[model samples]
Target chain A: MKTEAFVFDAYGTLYDVQSVSKITCEKFPRHGELITQVWRLKQLEYTWLRSLMNSYRSFWDITEESLIYTLDAVGVESDAATRAQIMDKYLHLDPHPDCHSALDALAGVPLAILSNGNQGILDTLVENTGLDRKLEATISVDKVGIFKPHAAAYELVEERLNVKPENVVFVSSNAFDACAAKNFGFRVAWIERVTRKAMNREVDEAEHVGPSTMFKLLRMQMEDLGMEPDYRLTSLNELVALR
Target chain B: MKTEAFVFDAYGTLYDVQSVSKITCEKFPRHGELITQVWRLKQLEYTWLRSLMNSYRSFWDITEESLIYTLDAVGVESDAATRAQIMDKYLHLDPHPDCHSALDALAGVPLAILSNGNQGILDTLVENTGLDRKLEATISVDKVGIFKPHAAAYELVEERLNVKPENVVFVSSNAFDACAAKNFGFRVAWIERVTRKAMNREVDEAEHVGPSTMFKLLRMQMEDLGMEPDYRLTSLNELVALR
Candidate 1:
């Protein structure tokens, strides 16, 4: 019944992955959005595919690989400048508006980030977002050579925190990540941000899939697999109430 | 390389899953296309998700479950009569025009189907489409309790046919399946039917993912992981040339 520590997913949960859209749209006005959509999906897919294949790649490498594929697939010219700009955008992803206050409210609780990002990327992201002071530890799945949804990724928390899996309250904006953590025996809190709808719907709309079918599939997968998130909320700020 | 047997993926490769459109259009009238796209994606997603979760469900149940979700998500009503009609459509999927001639040409070589379909559904599909006589065996993953892309599912071929994986020339229209078969040590022939382009693009266009980014990702995954299909052809009729 008692929670010992809070674990967070970095991309799309604490930080806005599409914050790069401004420069992306400026660089390639017509294809920027599709580039973002494809880039993000490929980033995650590469992780699972690698894990399933028993091959390993750092998240940083996967991010660049996916970005290259996105640029080619969307017919964007990926010059050196454009590549550098986008990669920097990833390094300096802006935290969600609620991030600071939510963590501030839960300052008494030990906080950590469990991310697919390599250690260097997580350190840069944390410092760039001014989250260094608030976070007790930042654990990267790079140590395990596999990505999230793999039980080994979750085990990093147990190893680092020295706490039982039951005592960890993992929070993620992604349903699959939350479901994976739940399957790994963590009490999960799913942060359902409002902007998440726009991202899901716009990507689905652009991909020509149904309005909400992608997100719906994620939820359905979680439900069908019997790994429902312990709690869902519109904002991470709601976590303060739990504390 | 001597291919002693040609093993096929039943659903999308041999049987046209979209053949259900005739009756679906009659019933839904307005949302038939979107329903088909969403239904197929959800069906495959369920299998992958279940495999990742290590929970298995019969493809029949997964097919029905995806249909129910598709109907509800797309705002179509799913009455008992409607459900029965759509489910019946799956049992009577039409095989591609090339299926007969291709198998006929390869009459000297043993032909079999290795599918995610449960035994009953595979039997019904084969019997309904008159493929029973042509197929030497219909191998279902039901006995293994897993779906395609999993090693265990592909093992069904070896177990049923008593052929080494290398001696079986595995064919799948789905790139992920092709990649998995390749990884499992089968010399794979990927059937690149023209309509596959429209289906991949439409689904991507509808799901708003990309023109063919999903398939592209599968190919990329295979390449990045060092598993590549040995051969690719435009039609099943091309199989005759292989001999």
Candidate 2:
């Protein structure tokens, strides 16, 4: 596929979502992992719920709200100072190790972030990680007042980059986002960073079970929903090969 | 607040979603609870995912798809006969202990179910549970080609009952659905059956911390998203008092 531009999901694909785990683990050694897991799950749920309700809030606010809910759920004391401290950590989240090198290799492609983050927060995220100089556009779905997996959110890439959906290579660590982008007509790739084995084994098992029949059934299901990811990679390092 | 019509959410509110736990436990003694929990979570997720993808599959299909995914995730062998047997359990799911008496007490009001279930499955479910004689309208969103919390799904109640939204009382055990119904202009009651104390305590603690100011803030957050549930009751029996 000759891709004209590459649009990436910001939070998990490029920036490691669990970067706060180090500080969090130090603060509450026992519940750090649970907090991180709950926070991220609530963050995603809030976005989808807000979208379905047609109530749009910036990702920053949703992040904070999710934090409060997480703290309450985990039976932690919600001290204001600790809350502000964690919120600050979000602003300075470190990028994944593969992020810079991959972006450097695909330097010629018009790159942008099509994120749920509001314009200001995403702008800071790009600049804080020195991705400001590397990326061509820092696109926010705030312009359309919705979140990812929504067609309009994906449309921002084409709108900002002035490229057709068919020409864009959209990448996300979130399988659902990648599937949504594919449904929106983008050639998509899912970065299977954590459960790489699970993804590979499912395909392999399907193939081994009944020749192409099982594989065909799986593919047909994805095709039926326009959710078939064009590629699955363990890291962004693999994107260089696609180029 | 005179309720001219009573519209209930079927699953989790009227019918116990965990009714299959008994049989499922006998089959998979070690992993039954995990399977049930995962199955319910994935079922809700598939609904939201499918809605966003603009690919509407009936609730029956989504239920089965979630079950398949849950079984695979748990590394259980997917047996065709076992799958069909569990699905059969769904059709004859027992109503909660409070369901019958509550429905009987409110016998004069027009009662209906606003659900995601397709007509056939819901029809069988209602009839199998003897809810057919009790409920005036067994409405399915299948007619609208969408699912619950969608404004259109709630609109069917007003249309069929020949009543205004203000005259309808929408009751659900699902927090999200209760909130959605409130947003849709119904007098909504949330049946806080399982986690009643937790929900009440959160609001109470928030209030105790800073007078009604904290309560106001908490309510405002819910109000902002149209998620404010007007009444929170521990049981359907309490619903009778609302009359």
**What value does the lDDT take at residue B197 in candidate 2?**
41
Task: Estimate the TM-score of every prediction.
Answer: 0.85, 0.87
State the fnat of candidate 2 relative to the true structure. Answer: 0.09
Could you say which candidate leads in DockQ? 1
**DockQ of model 2 vs. true complex:** 0.17
Error of 1 at A162 (Å): 2.0
DockQ measured for candidate 1: 0.23
Can you write out model 1's per-residue Cα lDDT over A140-199, one digit (the tens) per residue?
999989777778889999899998999889999877788789988999998766343444
DockQ of each: 0.23, 0.17
Best by lDDT: 1
What's model 1's interface RMSD, roughly to a tenth of an angstrom? 6.0
